[model samples]
Target: MAVGGLDLAKYCSSYDFNSNDVKSCSRAVDLTEACNWQKQRDDLEGVYKSADLHSGICLDPKGKDVGGIDDMLGFCRQKFKRTLDVRASDADGKDWRCVMDIDKDVVCIWQYSDKSLTAVQENGLWVCRRPADAASP
Candidate 1:
């Protein structure tokens, strides 16, 4: 079967599923789709928005079901060694927060509006500064 532009038959050779090589085999399959990884990350970044419950925080607007916040956190952690303070609001407007030990060097935050989101690049950090107009929390 072909999935995600990869042919399973070609990538999956006959190997003992219980052997130590299983990880290697899985990695080989994962690497085959690595070319799309950057685009996927960028696409996710495009949809990221400020959490409704917090003034200076941002998160995946689509929430956990889509894994957007988790994926972006992983990317930020891996590439920049920084973390984001992510938050969410329940339907009734109660706030739930998730914070990581943000690097002191993180000088920018995500700026989101009703129609758009912008990530600013500063000192190798790719996130927006808190909007000047945002009310303090």
Candidate 2:
């Protein structure tokens, strides 16, 4: 399933998602093929969005359901320390948001325009600068 331009590869891989029912229901089942999978996907994206919403504000990770920007920066710095420089970065200010896009693409602080900096999930990396008006809350 696709939504908000996201293929949701990892999400579609496992049927044990929080509320996604990955059943094709081919042979015999409900007439239509629709369930909470869509909802689960949305929920997961919400979590990532929450992280972006609080980026550069909260140093520690936010709620289990959500997280702040520092947490993601730390992930790139600590977990991928060896390749930290190759990864994206942001200034220590507000208005900068970074979230794994709907397609699992790395989207960082860019212009307010619809076209933002989004790197392909498979290759390349995403690095963006703080927007002109993205200096503070």
Candidate 3:
């Protein structure tokens, strides 16, 4: 399935924090961390506009209503805090990842090394595109 032109199955995975699937949850956390790292690098380099920052929010399945970015960040922060109790400083020091609702029920999280790839928010939805495509009118 695709949303905002993104092929969900090709680049995304889903996770239920309430489920017994520990691995899935862990994967979500790892992806979140990767996304956060990319965002920080982009910010440091001043490569993207402030509006584009929301693209970092993890995509969620439609109708799931997992709450806004803040809620997702809270969940991630709580999870990390539990695991890194001793280094709680590190947990809170970094930015917590988040989720955003989109059409269809799909979870999309990706880590891209290709600087050519970019995520831009349009009509309140995040769309991934190549630099050339994004520059076009």
TM-score of each: 0.17, 0.19, 0.22
In candidate 1, position 93 carries an lDDT of 42
The residue ranges of model 2 lying beyond 4 angstroms of the native Cα positions read 1-69, 89-137
> Candidate 2 lDDT, tens digit per residue, 63-90?
3333223334433333333332322233
Structure candidate 1, residue pairs in collision? 109-128
Which residue ranges in model 1 land beyond 4 Å of their true spot? Answer: 1-45, 48-67, 81-137
What's the C-alpha lDDT at position 12 in model 1? 24
Give the Cα lDDT of each candidate.
0.27, 0.27, 0.34
Give the Cα error of residue 42 in candidate 3, in Å.
Answer: 43
Q: Ranking by lDDT, best first? A: 3, 1, 2
| Top candidate by TM-score | 3
lDDT of 1 by residue, 76-132 (tens): 233323323322223234332222322221212111222222344455434444445
What overall lDDT, based on C-alpha atoms, would model 3 receive against the true structure?
0.34
Give model 3 RMSD, 1 decimal. 18.9
Candidate 1, after superposition: displacement of residue 41 in Å? 4.7
TM-score of 3: 0.22
Superposed Cα deviation of residue 88, candidate 1 (Å): 14
lDDT for position 26 in model 3: 30
